[model samples]
Target: MRGKSSIEVSAKLKHSFLFPDEYLDWANETENNFYVESPLIYEVAFYNGIKALKPWETIEYIPVVLTEWKKVKLEIESKFEKRDAKGATLPMRVGIGLFLELLFWTNGQPVELNPIIPLESLKIKPVNITERFAFILARPNLFHSYKQLAELMVEMEKLYVKSIIVRK
Candidate 1:
């Protein structure tokens, strides 16, 4: 087995197009990928023409958040144990690598975040914002090819850009 398969991440992400009104409902059970389109889910969330949805930017899929399952309390062998024994699911928040599909060179520099902030900064915060999130900037068509996808990932790594903050 690999090292990560054995490790457990505590928290996971649940993305939304717009931040939800009730933080309570933020953790809906059903899948919330924008491609799913459930009011809450959003596919390609943009910010500014450049910042939120930059052109030629590529992103790597990273596990940034953990969807923590509700902890189950149990007793075994005369000892109390709390384990990931019940239904627990979450999204691993991801950081994207940036690059231009058209322009091969002129790789942009990353804004060094000395201490990264969980709350992603947006040019304009959605009307009702709560949790912050991110996404890729390419059109869906580009993802079809392995070579194109690989190029995106490679450039995404070089740029070191963060994802967008989505709301339900």
Candidate 2:
């Protein structure tokens, strides 16, 4: 069914992504049940048990607080650090670099990714519509959830920057 097609699409298009295959698979699996019209578009069906229902309101939820989100981010980063000797960090750095490049290319802004510097030393770069469009075009299956995760991380970084400014 829908899940099978989605998995096939994800696997076929995996080359464009900088993320690990397993991580990308985890991100793509959640979206399997939804209908995909094309690589860039998908339809989500909602049911009321009795019958299918038209979508009404989609509730926006930010269940994780800033602290909790940061903790999760740190845990991921720690795992990367531990596996750095095994080449874990390269994919992460490449993923982050690709995201930053997309941001820069879309916004016509300059960005630099120095491997020698700590990730914290890098500036926060917010994603925009044009860049998102490019991402969807490249990997539509990953667009929804992955973009949300990236945006949340960007927002968290912005909040951290603001906190430092306020503290000073």
Summarize candidate 2's per-residue lDDT along 1-168 as a digit string, tens digits: 223322222232233333234222213343432221111111111111112221111111112123334544454455545644234333333334334333332222323222221223334444453455345434433324344545745764564456446656
Candidate 2 deviant stretches above 4 angstroms: 1-6, 10-15, 18-59, 62-72, 80-168
Best by lDDT: 2
Question: Per-residue CA lDDT of candidate 1, range 1-168, in tens?
Answer: 311111111112122312222132222222222111122111122211111222213322121111110011011111212322121111101111111111111222222112332223423222222221122222211222222323443433333332223221
Evaluate residue 121 in candidate 1 and report its C-alpha lDDT on the 0 to 100 scale.
48
Estimate the TM-score for candidate 1.
0.19
CA shift of 77, model 1, Å: 46
lDDT of 2 at 83: 46
Please list the residue runs of candidate 1 whose C-alpha ends up more than 4 Å from where it truly belongs after superposition.
1-27, 30-41, 44-62, 65-144, 161-168
lDDT of the candidates, in the order given? 0.21, 0.34
